[model samples]
Every structure is written in structure tokens, then in C-alpha cells.
Target: MTQQLLLDILPGALPTLETFVAGVNHAAVDAVRTLTPGHALYLWGGQGSGRSHLLRARAQDPDGHYLDARTPAHWLQSLATDEDRVLTLVAVDDVGELSDAAQAALFALFNRWRAAASTPDAFALLTAGDRAPLTMPLREDLRTRLGWDLVYRIEQLSDDDRAQALHDRALQRGLKLPDDVLHWILTHYDRDMGRLTTLIDTLDQYSLAQHRPVTLPLLKALLTRQHPDPASHHADAGRTSP
Candidate 1:
């Protein structure tokens, strides 16, 4: 299957994981490395925090099996067999959304997977929006079992990290962004990397459509169009002037 198809089928793009900067937090990286075979590792963080990105990167292994725990049955079905040699890695995103029955199924799967001495070289990684599985409306058993594994709360990017992330994304898209435009985006929009990446994409489209470079004027125009407040635009325009 094409990379695009794989991405569409998978919860998130795994290739992007290599590009994810874990920053100075060796704890997250160390936890990921210690993921033992037949055990589940829980990675939790707020939205736009790149949890799925890390999980997808781990899924790139040829023997990886990615199941969307949002659909509980698929998660169970993927883990049902004892054929560990077939699948070396399993990643589930939005695992907190699994229903009670699904949680029970997961608990059983984890126990079975953990009990098998010859359980191949397979590892399971789960991502959630909360710090602990207990915070989610999960079964007590699943919550208790999930707590047994290492859990890391991924941190949001710092201001410098966010700026660097924007620069990297713009470079990847083959766009030369001016410092002013970058500053304008960082100042006005949400500081989240995901949103900034999207803003860059939209700016790219706007620039292409107008046959204009991504200058302050074009960016201001786009932002104004999206949120039309003439007074605010005029004030911003004045502030940006030399």
C-alpha cells in the first residue's frame, strides 16, 4: 500500500515520529526504549501534544500491527491470536474511548499476552488524552493492569520549540517563510505546533493563489479575512510598520 493509504488507514503518520523532537525530556525516550515484549506501555498527554506521532513512529517497524482502540473489536481482534511472530509491535490511539466491554477485552488480551512465555517479540503501545487510565471511564481491571506499565506524560513544546517546529514544517513544504510572517503567526494563532503547521499550510495556499510571497501583508489579509475585525486589523497593521 502507498504511504498515503497506510497513513489514512493508520491512526496517524508514523514516519513523522522520526522528526519529533523529544526535547530535553530523557524520561519519555527512556520509557519508550524500555517497552518490553508482551507488555503494554501507556503514553498520555493533552491534545496537540504529539502522542499519536510517537506511537506512529514506533509502528513503522515492519512487524508492527496498528489498531484503532476507538474501535474496540479491531483492537481485540488484532491481539487475539498467539502468533507473536507475525506482529512485533501493536499501537492503539485514543484508547481511552474504548467502552467497558472493550476495556475488559483489552484486560484479557493483556493478561494473555503477558502470560505467554514464548509470546514472540511483540510490544503494545497505547495513547490516551489523560494522565492515567483510571481517569478515563475504563474498567477497574484494565485500569489496574495499565498502571503496571510505564506511563509518561508528554510535555507540550516550549516557545522556542514551537517556533522551531514551525520553521521545520515550512522548510518541509518547500516554503521560504520570512521571520516577520513566522512572528505574526506565532503571535496571533494558537502556539500549538499542530495548529501552527496547519496555519503554515493555509498560508502556503493563500500565497500560491494570490501569486504573492508569504509576506506580512498577505498574512494579515488572510488573518483578517478569517476573523474580520477592521479596527483590530488596522491596529495590527500600524504595529507591524517600521
Candidate 2:
């Protein structure tokens, strides 16, 4: 099998709430599901904890707008004053990364949303970050504003939970992933759900190409071929200037 068939980039389709392995995050999931106009939710968690996934899902709702820290101030200001806008969701992801001007715009937009909260059953704002509102090192006023709203910490999936999620994903694609194989991958490979899920599709393609079952050896072979010796770079770097 040609190892040239690596696919660690394209992680397939966007994640949905259904695809999310809730684990101990039922409260967080429930918050997003029950989110309505006049309400704001702040979710915080480490990377790979499915924070961005949920935000992206909600942002796909009707009239939903997804923003990140890199979003420009002008765009946010526009949203704030878009008179005809009937927003169902305003999902601001990675709040910690927002620029100063963007933060100010967000503050204004938040106040606008709050000012109209008396009849706020038509729009919702969602923000996410790496730390809880009380701990995030952001503008004090912005942090305080976010703190006033509903906050939830998204829990990272445990190893067993991750395996089950991967198995279910593989099953959705009509591929049977053995428990042992899943466990081994968890231990020996990148645990990012996105990459693991993409690996499923990649393995499916490679299996058909090589006409082999999705066994431990096949996985090992694929992974080995895809990821060569990591220490090679260090060895090459050691040959630096004298």
C-alpha cells in the first residue's frame, strides 16, 4: 500500500449536537439546545473538548452568525446595528482571541441584545473560551458581562468515551471498528476527535485500496506510513552550525 494516501487534514463534515459525545457535558448540551432569544451562554473548556464543534453547530441555525476573535470590529458593529437582522444565534467562538476593537464591538452588541431582552425570544448569543468567565484574562467589563449570563464548562471525553464515539462514527459509515483497535488508537495516536474521525474515513479508503480488514496490523501499518520517525527532525537539527 502506498503511504501517500494520508488524510489528516480533511476531517469530513461539520459536527452536530447529535455527533457530540456528551459524557458529563449534559448541562452544556442542554444549554445550547434550550438557547432562545434574550439568552446568552458562555462555554469554556480546553482545546479538543468539543467547544468549537458545538458553537459551529448552533451558528448554522436560522439567521445565525458565527464570529471568532479574529472577526473585524466593523463586522461586529454592523451586526450590532443591522436593523433588519432577526438573528436566531450569534455564536462568538474563542472570546479570548478577540481584538480590542472587536471586544468593544462585542460589548456593544451584547448590551444591545440585553436591552431588548424584555421580548428576547427570537435571538441568542453564545460565547466560548479556554477558561471560565471568572478566570479568563479579558477586558474586565466584557468578562463581567459574560459572567452575568449562563456559564458551563464542557468536559473533555475520557478514553473510553472517545473510543465509543469513534466506534459509533465508524459504524455510521458502515465500518466495524473493533474495541481493541479503537483503544490502541487512543493510546498510540493523536486523540483529537477530528483527526480520529478523519482517520476512520481514511482507513476505509485505504482498506478498500489494499483489500485488507480493519485490523490492528492494518492500522499500525497505516499510521506508521503516515507518521514517520518524529525524532528524525531532532537528529537533523543536531547537525546545526558549529
Candidate 3:
């Protein structure tokens, strides 16, 4: 059976848990799936590893709040001590890039959460960084604390995984994306799963407009529109930026 593409998600790529391609991160996904109150999970990985996606998905909970390096310091501090706040689930991303004040706020928040683990306001905190906890450059206390609970490094998708994802997406859309066409796209264009999947979306649209089946020639034509001009036209049809 063909794997399903995530392109058909409601509201379009909203980063829900269901839309996440587990790949080799099944254990991490399951950990987040069953994350309990007062517990914490820290995820570290290089770019394109879907750390941000998971954090955004977890923050969809009614009581959950998502924080990142871009989040304001005051808000971070506020959440740390807001007595009115009840329940659990705080998802923090890009922890390594947090501002000085934000780092302090998060430090306090961690202490409070851990101290209240047995209390009514006990909560769960999920964090992500570009590297493993101890190696992350941050305030010493916070850096050490990140390793106190669960930690997992997210792995990037393999080529087979990417192919399967795109193949699945085509099936879900009820479109015909030939295996050769898939291989061509993988070889010629950007390999990032997001962009590759986006091309699939574009191909579907072009196919609909032209009233034709998906084929190598049609794929080349679509990329031609993307990469106009004689100079780039011949050197690798899909060399245009994704």
C-alpha cells in the first residue's frame, strides 16, 4: 500500500500530531503522544527534523502554550508565575536562541513546575534545541536542567521515507504520480521533504489545469515554467530554486 501524503490536512499544514511523518522518531512521537502532567520532554535535532512541527502540534491543546526564541520575555515570565493558569503542556522551541531574560524566565518556570509536580498546578514542559542538552550553549543551570527529564534527538527523513511520503500524498489526492516522475523530482529538485511535497502540490495543480496525467514530460514542462530563460532551460530541468 502507498503511504499517504500529509498534503490533505485540514486547514493546510497546521502541524497536528496526526500529520507528522514519524519516520525514525517513533519513540519520540510516542513519548509526546503520552506525555503526562508534571513530566518533561526535550527534543534536539538539526534543521528539517520537525522539532518545530511537533511543538506547534502539542501547543494546540486548550491548556497548552507554545514558546520559542521569538516569544517575548515578559510572556515567558508571566506564564512562569501566573497563578490563574491551570493544567499542563508548555511547548518551548529554539531554546538555544532564547534571550537572556527569557532564559531566566524559563529557568524559574522549570523550578516552579518541578516543585509543583504533586500539586494541582503541576504541568508538563516540552522543549527543543538544535543540539543535545548538555552541548547546547545556554545558562549553566538551565542547560543542566534540560537533561533532567526525557531527551530525544529527532532524525531527518531518509530518501525512501521522502519518496514514500510523496507517493502516499499522491494516492490521497487520487492523482497519478509515476515512480519515474517521483525519482526525477527527487533527483532534480530540492530534497527537503517540505519543498518536495510542495512540488507535488504544484504538480497536482498543473495536472488539473492541463487535463493530463502526471508524467516526466509534464513534470519537465512544469519545472520549465518555474525555471524560465534559455541559460537555465537546458542545464538540468529542475535546477531552479525550490
The 10 consecutive residues of candidate 1 with the worst lDDT sum are: 233-242
Q: Give candidate 3 misplaced runs (Cα > 4 Å).
A: 1-11, 187-199, 209-242
What lDDT score is found at residue 155 in candidate 1?
86
> What is candidate 1's CA lDDT for residue 198?
55
Per-residue accuracy of model 2 over 1-242 as CA lDDT, tens digit each = 22222444233566678867788999899999888888899999997788877887788776788877656678887777775767777888888888888888889888878877767434788889999897777789899888768999998899888888888888887887887788777876665565567678888777778898899898877766654644331100010010
Give candidate 2 regions above 4 Å deviation. Answer: 1-11, 120-122, 178-180, 216-242
Question: What would the per-residue lDDT of candidate 1 be over residues 1-242, giving only the tens digit for each residue?
Answer: 00011111112222344466666545775666556566667887776576766666666666665455445464565465455446555666666777666666667667665666254544564444446667866767777766677777888777788888788888988899999988877666664444455567777777898899899888777665543333331100000000
* TM-score, every prediction: 0.69, 0.81, 0.79
lDDT of each: 0.60, 0.75, 0.76
For every candidate, C-alpha RMSD to the true structure in Å: 10.7, 8.2, 8.0
TM-score of 3: 0.79
lDDT of 2: 0.75
